[model samples]
Target: MSSIANTDEPAAATAQGHGHSASTLTLAVGAVGVVFGDIGTSPLYAFRETFAAHHGAIGITPDAEHIHGVLSLVFWSMMMVVTVKYVLTIMRADNKGEGGSLALLALIRRASDNRRWTAPLILLGVFATALFYGDSMITPAISVLSATEGLQYIVPGFKPWIVPTAVAILFGLFAIQSRGSGKVGKLFGPIMLTYFGMLATLGVMHLSANPAIILETINPINALRFFQADGFTAFIALGSVVLAVTGAEALYADMGHFGRKPIGLSWLTFVFPALMLNYMGQGAMILSASSPAAAAALVKDPFFLMIPDLVRVPVIILALLATIIASQAVISGAFSLTQQAIQLGFIPRMEIRHTSASAAGQIYIPTINWGLMVMVILLVLFFQSSTNLAAAYGIAVTGAMFIDTLLLAAVLFSLWRWPVWKALPLVAAFLIVDVAYFGANLIKVPQGGWVPLLIGFVIFTLLTTWSRGRELMRASMSESALPIEIFAKSAQNSATRVAGTAVFMASTNTGVPSALLHNIKHNKVLHERILILTVAVQDVPYLESIERYSCKDLGNGFYRVTIRCGFLEETDVPALLRTLDLCGAPFDMMHTSFFLSRQTLLASAKPGMAIWREKLFAWMLRNAASAMEFFRLPTNRVVELGSQVEI
Candidate 1:
């Protein structure tokens, strides 16, 4: 892939006279809407369950001092991991407006032109991406179930209906994906705004009642008490506390949609403070109450407990709205991840149907949509409660966080060229926090954590095998490519006698493509007018439309056409041809036949790879849907030419 274009601040900064005003506030709120869904909703269950979940065999006494200690850890974890590490520092390390594992890889690749660290960086990027898959699957299940569990709190008799209702709501959500979210996205901001307001109001009200020095939980000393009392239990608490910062990655990933300034300000000014206050309020509630069962009572309906009886209905409505917005964020994230996977060549191209005419990123992939729906339904059925889903959640989030630290360290050392002394300490701090969370979550493997790890490992193996197989196939084919001059000199004479035009798809521009070669060697025919086309998939999330396509005419009735698409956009050959006015390319497509080269990987022990990987690649290649259907081409006009590749 060619280097991704960087056109953010540095370029603008150099052009001093014309300045662009960065709206720090707007981007931050939008980022909050997009990024905060996962972590923001965690307050509904994080604390209550940490003390009561199956993982915590020895539940902490739900007393004032103990509650303060746990809440303190939650607050500090958010400050250190989300606020200090990600918001204050990591967001500044973005590649132009793009951020994520892949974006970081491109930045490091650009800096280290020597390719010495390419393998490690790319592997880390792919591994981080695989972990994201695990996170996406759980976010929906946990967020919605947690919010819906409030039903039992309002009316004790509704306990049995909570699971069924949550499942039905999730089903409807997935079913509407094909219709697109543009219609509903307009209301997400409004709904989330109200929810945040409600949380802030309830927190302030609770804080007013306990006006004594209870606010002292903000001090670092009290947080130290939890560890001193029980070090092993407190260490395990890091994994659950880390959940408070789950969505920080989205701050960087969604930076392009809304600029850096807005996202940063939103977290610092509004979202962060509101979250801290609500958590503190929960701590206060735990401290002041005189019953051992108070925590359990509040857990059933904590958000409503702060609201009076008359306003409970409004609060319930607000919480439901917030849950919908939260689910929407994760659904959109899944779409983005699928596009990135395709661009990086881990997964074969799928039919990415665009939903909005104006928004290039608004896409609908049927395969991914249906796949996630099935898995989420199964999760709702098996786990049956948010408390159960929580056990499965930390594994994915912490694993991804750990991988992010590893890649970020590579970026600091190799890309930014930071000195060893400065870089090592920063790297060590992140890794220590990340590893602690990862190890803590490991204890839940048999309970629920094994699901994501198993899925991630399976996906990672396929990704590595396919990427390596593609490399071997290219190396072997490059050795066999016929010289362009010799092919033009010999085959240019009396190739065939078709009427209007024929286009043959080739992976490389120089060689006579596999399809054309097969047509010439067996049928002894070509076309009166011929064109060879190569489509290059780019790594960036968005591409400039004006420079979206380029074509060159090779002499002797052949033309080389290359089309570029952002990782966020799908390539439609027919649509591209119509726009470029080159269906026939000095010849017309109304009378053209398009030839596509299809590769079938066969199991081999000939030494290209370990025998195990060869078998794995063969299985994936067989299972992948055909290119003709994937790209949404005209069935009658398309023809596939087959070739075998041994890997």
Candidate 2:
């Protein structure tokens, strides 16, 4: 379940749509800049935090054995969790070339014919999405703060400036969302390319001095020896170790932009090696410290200290830039994910604006953007430092990863039809890692870990409540509706026929909208031509232009039209109608008067969801964005008709 290209690339087409030549290389470079940001920036804090003295009493001396052990675990987690699980296996479980939790859920719904397991699968997918929201909030806080925390090493008296500086940078980042990321995205590739080059360069400098550390880290025996060396301490260390693989899921989520090959190329050939080299370099630097005091200081900030003193300041500057980019990617992912959730009917409609006219996928959501800003800022202020925030960061990510493994199991068995023998081993390996990381993170719930779980719980409730409420409202409204044939014959001669076209928007395709019935009752007149329109969202990303709209004549100048929209697409009704050729007359926004139904929900004693949820649904419905603006209808021509409905 993965990527809605939260990118503003006017010229970017998915790599699967291009040749694997120069263009493919370009996509891979772009992937390095955006797709790998989260994981790429992990070196700034992940390795150092694993052996921090402040991480309770679990951490031990960062000596030869522990350094090899930690590096071994980091290397293997990257290989298995990122390379094997996400890049190799789960990336293949795409929905029309799109990947993400909601995208995967849509794929499963479209692929499965068996109805029994669908309900729980839907719940799993929704919970995964909820966890993603939590991850998005934490990623920015931890990433930026960790990088800026490097200031103390650069300028010893700069400790107080770190928080204020991070806060300023974050505020500026969120403030720029409405302007679009096209120019910013074009710069991402170069900045990250430079950033990763530095990481590899610093790593190679240390590894050249000590090739033995490299040899010791590559063997799985070191990881095993680590567990055998400190059993319970090593297990608790996993909560920190998992921070290395935090953004692996983003690779799959972002697959629709660059395709599997480009993302794989970026990771395997470039991003992956750079990350491993940096982690190993940190280990080598820690093990080679000239003094015990130096060793202790290096262990606290291995990534920054690994660089030579002369180059440390520049590297710190680059790390800050990279972290900013990482935070931007996570924020964009949240916007894209929210758009999918709205289209899939899991969330109430909000104000969504296209930031780029050329790329439909690049969007800005005011509500989600501002909401995330508030939460992220609160997290940074509350946690006060990246070390404290680390306890909160991994739970959401690990929980989402475990849920993805479950969804992948479903995809393998049901969609791919993989034999049990092949699928079992893969699923089992993924489960071992996911369950271990998730269980380890559970140990942190009492220590700042409750933040993400609390966020996930609230989000999950809102999602389910909205989905179920929509169903109940539709059922209630459908029970009181009149069919087209019945309404048409009855209204034919009952009122004066006017000259303009009347377009009534309907939520359900089979019945007359309450707006039309209310219109006739109040106005005592009808337009010469009446159009019953319904915009339907299908479980796909993009639909063909020719199959955009279908209109069927209901006789007597009445027609029922349905607009087919893909989940990853926009619903611009008037713009779409301009291209539509109906039998009687061409669609003109100026000539058409759009009538919209605004439902006022009441929490009835009727058998439905709980009374509290019904009231919550009522509030959501009332606060939802206007259908006219959401569908891109003409501002002056739209009229709203209100009706109260009980569920």
Q: Which stretches of candidate 1 lie over 4 Å from their true place?
A: 1-26, 211-215, 292-301, 497-499, 543-554, 574-588, 610-612, 623-625, 629-636
* Superposition error at 192 for model 2 (Å): 0.3
**Model 1 Cα shift for residue 488 (angstroms):** 2.2
- Each candidate: RMSD to true structure? 4.1, 4.1
Q: Write the per-residue lDDT of candidate 2 for residues 244-285, one digit (tens) a residue.
A: 999999999988878888999889899988888888888878
Clashes, model 1: 6
What's the TM for model 2? 0.96
Best by lDDT: 2
lDDT of 2: 0.86
- Give lDDT tens digits, candidate 1, residues 396-456: 8888878778878877887778999999999899988888889988988988999889878
Q: What is the C-alpha lDDT of each candidate?
A: 0.71, 0.86
